[model samples]
Target: MRDHGIGHIVGTILDAPENASVVKELKEHAREAGFKAGYNECLSHVNPFYKSKFTDERSGFHGVDTKALYAAAVDTYNNLSISAIDDIEEFLEAENYVDRLRLLYDYPEEEETASGSKEDAGTSGTKED
Candidate 1:
């Protein structure tokens, strides 16, 4: 189970300080759905691919296994609260789901920043030369 970006993606979601509550929610949902993908050597990529905190041993994994992990991640993201993500339709429509996850990971911060800028600008928000 080599690091085929799944470890990075999952780690990004689960390891973020801002996502502590979100991780709890995800774990609950995963439990309800019988998803053990986050743990167990049979499921988690990190368990098999990562040998240490700073090392990644590439043993390589099957396409089917990779697809299953990706699907689990995609489904988890899709099930996130609306408050966590304003709109997930665009992400669902993307052909490249892996890249979509990367985008989704950054979407919330981008959205918050954009909305904050709008509020700061107020009405007649045109930029002056």
Candidate 2:
């Protein structure tokens, strides 16, 4: 776990924050997915014969150990990106699974309003019943 990895981890967490129990869950999953490859590639370049990846085959880790990785990733994410995560979460909901297609048709707004003007957002008067 290093200070530098948090930004990438946080980006993964924010991508699907709803599924994540905590920021760490997201980080661990992301790291397990491809970060390990990238991490190992860099490490190998530094010491091609000696350095190993973050996970070792002797440990029998076919994939990320979610429980263990969660601890490390969360600790790193919290320490480095708690404030950034907080702000990001504030701007968007963790899980936003709206029925977009249904809503798009059900509540079809004027073209101008849909294009998003703040003034129009207040006066989208299609529902004037």
Candidate 3:
């Protein structure tokens, strides 16, 4: 688990007009970090700005156990700051809801590390991205 709420913070910062500079820096950092896709994927899953693909009736994520994920997101949002943008990939690691699902389903880990972090080495093939 990487902290607990980077993902929620990312969405919050990305939406705040006062954080434009911070968002700019965070976007550049995300690209350099190799977890851009994962961040985008995370946003697509939980960010209201992104309208969350997972919330779509046609999305495969539909009917999945997102209660915990949403609750965590809400809790995270309640206590976020601009400074939390660092180590954004940890957002995915925040709740591990998706990771847990993948693990439970026996999804094989891809050799390529999405975030170039040892912790995320097994996070490929999530398909949600």
What is candidate 2's lDDT per residue for 1-129, written digit by digit as tens? 122233544554556444345655656566665555565566567765565534344333355554566566656656654444454444334232122221322333324345456333253323343
Residues 1-129, candidate 3: write the lDDT tens digits.
233334444565577654665445445444434343444467575766564344345444444444454445445555556543443444345565556534433445534358665455354424443
Model 1: pairs clashing at backbone N, Cα or C within 3 Å:
none
Tell me the TM-score of each prediction against the true structure: 0.23, 0.23, 0.20
Provide the overall lDDT of each model, using Cα atoms, as 2-decimal numbers.
Answer: 0.45, 0.46, 0.47
Best by lDDT: 3
Indicate whether candidate 1 or candidate 2 has the larger lDDT: 2
Clashing pairs in 2: none
After superposition, candidate 1 runs with Cα above 4 Å error: 21-90, 99-129
Whole-model alpha-carbon lDDT for candidate 3: 0.47
Lowest-sum lDDT 10-residue window in model 3? 1-10
Which 10 consecutive residues of model 1 have the lowest summed lDDT?
Answer: 118-127
